[model samples]
Target: MRLSCLQENLSKGLAIVGRAAASRSTLPITSNVLVATDEGRLKLSATNLEIAVSCWIGAKIEEEGATTVPAKLLTEFIGSLPNDKIEMALSAKKILTMKCARFEARMTGVDARDFPPIPRVENGVAVKVDVAEFKKGVARVVFAAATDESRPVLTGIDALFEGSVLTLAAADGFRLAVYKMPLAEAASQKVKAIIPAKTLSEVSRLLSDGDESIGITVDTQKSQILFKLKNVELVSQLLQGAFPQYSQIIPQSHTTRAVVETPAFLMAARTAQIFARDGGGIVRLIMTPGGGKTPGRLSITARSEEIGEDQAELDAAVSGEEAKIAFNGKYLLDVLGVISEGQVALEVTGPSSPGVIRPVGTDNYVHVVMPMFVQW
Candidate 1:
């Protein structure tokens, strides 16, 4: 393949698809990216069996052909070169020659036929949604997905589409996150599937154009899902297993509630965590309302014999009586970090019950974190 393209365009395309190249795979082809020149453009493709990414960049094509080269090496080399135009040509014996102003490098390559064929979006139902909206939904819930592979279903986020509404949910036994958003165009029919977190993360990163919309198609029969943007496409294999009924775990009501600034609460929890190592990184929250109509004070405390103790207090809108609750510091901070809004509502039943954290105005998104028990 012989093509001339801008350095920035080529570098961006390589960075996007290069993520899917297997770092250590038994098959040598899996470690390489397929570069093909066609229709006056250069196409970059990479896959690791489960996930695949393809990107196209406008290029001056002198010859139409395809070749495979190591993804990391090419990306690093291209990134280090000057910002001038780059000319790439594949010669006989499968060698790739890259040339820029006053610089040139010849790299060994493999036959394009050795690369695995990426799945196509043909015959799949397409749903369109705004890029930023879709990315926000994924970000809110993807972090809650279980990292442990024992329960394959919990390791993925559940995506459900009904009418024009899209919902993303994830749970790891200890906590759960759910986010819902409206889609611009809905599929004629409803669709539900469990998509791995790794796949969703890649999709989120590929959505660089904020004004653009994304087309998502799912092939249930083949257990594959594809995401299409302006000049990029990603295909991933769906996780096979039934996700648990997470709705049953969410509490309907709580005896105590507090509305506090999201950033303030997160900072306090993080600081308290420094002293909570002995108790599995637990942080305690005590909500006490002063007399009259003044805002209540929420005090966060963490105590460990080895690390001493730390405490912080913040003003909050509290209802009900005084209450003290303990929770895992990391879980609380993770939920807080994903919320974009300013104010957060914390609903609790007691120390042993699960604490729910949610944005002040929205019921469409909710985070449930199980609290830990505190002695004395």
Candidate 2:
């Protein structure tokens, strides 16, 4: 097999599919990227059994053949070459010969026949989502997913497509994040799937590389989902489990609400975290109601035996009864770090119940965080 392609294109294509190459696997082929010629173009693909990535780059194919090479070695070699044309040839003995302007190398490879087949979306319900909106939505919720694999369900993001809207939700027992966005095109039918957070995070990163909308296909029978962009495609296995009923955990109503600037709130949380780290990461949010002409005040405080206490106050448009709540400073910072809105509304029923954080003027997103117990 022989092919010639631009170095930049080959480097970019390798980067796109290299993320799926298995780092530690019993099968050596799992860590290799498949290089093949398809329809006069060079295709690069890698899979880690759970997820697969494929990328196609423009090339001149002399002899059509395929082979598998170490993903990391190929990517690094291509990335180090000049931006000139690169020539590659695979010999019958499974050796990949690569040549650039001033450098040439021969790398050992395996036959492409050993690589696992990447599932194709032959027929499935396709939905289109705006790239910017999809990335933003994913950023807001993916962080809430549990990193620990103890409960596999909580380590995935729940994707629900109904009507013309798509909802993505993630929870780690202590906190939950949910985001809804209007699809560019309506789905053919209702579809629900739990996708691993790592896969969704990769999809989000790929979306940022281009401004084009993304095509999503869900194949429930095969238990796989496909995401297609202009030049890259990602396919991942759906998590096999029923996601928790998240709606019931959200508070029906809040007894108190406060609107404050998100940046200010985040700063307060970060400052409190320094001392809170020694005290079980506990931070206090005290909302004091205003009477007559005075405006309500929200105070963020943290205290530790080894470190002095710290506090920050911000005026808020508080309504309903005053409430005080304690929460983990790190969790509060995580929620605040992902919010894009300038102002956020914090709602709570009481100190014992979960506190809900919503971006002001946005009804499509909600964040609920459980409170920590503290002796008053």
Candidate 3:
């Protein structure tokens, strides 16, 4: 194999595909990145048994061949080279040789045929989604996925595509996050799949700022999902199991509603977290509505018996009735940090019930947090 490519493109491609290379795996080939010439471009791929990433970069191919090299070594070496042309060649003994500018190196590699084959999915129900909206939805929903491996279903995001809409829902048993966005193209039939949060996060990160749309294919026959970007492709195995019926978890109505500014609420939560760290991570939220010409108030407080207590108040648009709720300080910070709207609405039925949070101007997102059982 012989090929020449720009250092910049090779470096970027390595960085993108190297993410899937397994650091510690039972299969040694999974730690290597497969390099080959496809059509008129160079293809770099890596897999860790769960997900695979493939990136194509332009190159001048003198001969057609393939080999697997250490991902970390190649990425580091290519990244250290200057912005110049890199010439690479492979020998029959599985030796990968490369030259860039004034530097040259030869490394031992493995036969490419031993590397895991990336599942090729062509016949499947495909849906296109706007890149910007898809990234936003992933950012809002993936954080709620369960990190514990005991419940496998909760570790994945519930993806539902029907007609022209796509919904992403994730939960960790304590909190739930749901986001909906219009698809760039309409789907022919309803499709449901549970995609791992880690894979979706990587897909979101791979989407460049210049990308306009992303194509998602649900291949039920293969039990895998594929994401196709402009120059990159990601394939992940679907988790087998039934996701929770999350539609019933979202509250339909609320007795107490409070509208608070996003920045203010986030700031209060951040401050409360500092003190709540010593107090079992509990933060208290008290909403008081005003009558006549008086203004409404929302108090955020946290206390530690060994340390001290702190509280911050913000003017809010409160209605219905007064409410006091205790919540995990970290949970409050997580949901509030994702909200970008000017004001956020909080709906609570009572101290024992879950609190629903929604951005005032957007109906596309909703978050539910269970209240902590603590003394008032």
**Which 10-residue span in candidate 1 carries the lowest summed lDDT?**
205-214
lDDT tens readout by residue for model 1, 160-243? 877898889999999999898888888767888899999999899878865478988887888889998899999999999898
Candidate 2 local lDDT, 224-342, one digit each (tens): 99999998899999999999999999998999999999998998899999989998999999998888999998999999988789999998989998899999998899999999459
Model 1, total clashes: 0
Q: Which candidate would rank higher by TM-score, 1 or 3?
A: 3
All candidates: CA RMSD in angstroms?
Answer: 1.4, 1.0, 0.7
Q: Which pairs of residues collide in model 1?
A: none
- The better-scoring model by lDDT among 1 and 2 is 2
List the candidates ranked by TM-score, beginning with the highest.
Answer: 3, 2, 1
* Regions more than 4 Å wrong, model 3: none
Better of 2 and 3 by lDDT: 3
- Candidate 1 has an lDDT of 0.89
lDDT of 3: 0.95
Screening candidate 3 with a backbone cut-off below 3 angstroms (N, C-alpha, C), the clashing residue pairs are none
